[model samples]
Target: MTMEFGPDDQIDYDGPVTPYRQLAEILRARIARGDWAPNRAIPSEARLVQEYGPARTTVRRAIKVLVEEGVLFVVPQRGTFVAERSSEDR
Candidate 1:
């Protein structure tokens, strides 16, 4: 199944892979493809759970990895978002 990481890196996951990594890959692909522009609001953990059918902790772990990698950022209440990092930052 093809997953589309939309403008905000939200995905329609349909793979047998581990959900958290799948989720991370979706975000990575979106950034690589420029589907998600820099500094855009990414889907929240709750939104991701709904989309990926994963546990909250799993989603949070995926997001945390992205944040650590400079692929995403978390703002209190505002939610996670795509970070505007240059290629060198990756």
Candidate 2:
């Protein structure tokens, strides 16, 4: 059960983990690796679906997890952005 992730990691559909969880881990790694700066918007849901070959629902679910974990935030029509680090995260 290796759950570790890092920048440049790709989703392995053959692995034990579900695709949505893999996507969440990948997104987390991307954020930690500075793929997108805090408060910067990541790619849109449609783009993510096209890039990762996941269903839109799966992508949304992964984004929801990051949002709940404070790693990302959504601005309705604007799109999802990386969250500002709290004092604790710093």
Assess each prediction's global lDDT (C-alpha) against the native. Answer: 0.74, 0.91
After the best TM-score superposition of candidate 1, give how far the Cα of residue 38 lies from its true spot, in angstroms. 1.2
TM-score for candidate 1, residues paired by index? 0.69
10 residues in a row with least lDDT, candidate 1: 4-13
Model 1 per-residue lDDT tens digits across residues 14-61: 556566766787767767777667778876778778876778998888
Residue range 1-90, candidate 2, lDDT tens digits: 878766577778898988888999999889988999999999999999988899999999999999999999999999999999999897
The backbone clash count of each candidate, in order, is 0, 0
Which window of ten consecutive residues has the lowest lDDT sum in model 2?
2-11
What's the lDDT for candidate 2? 0.91
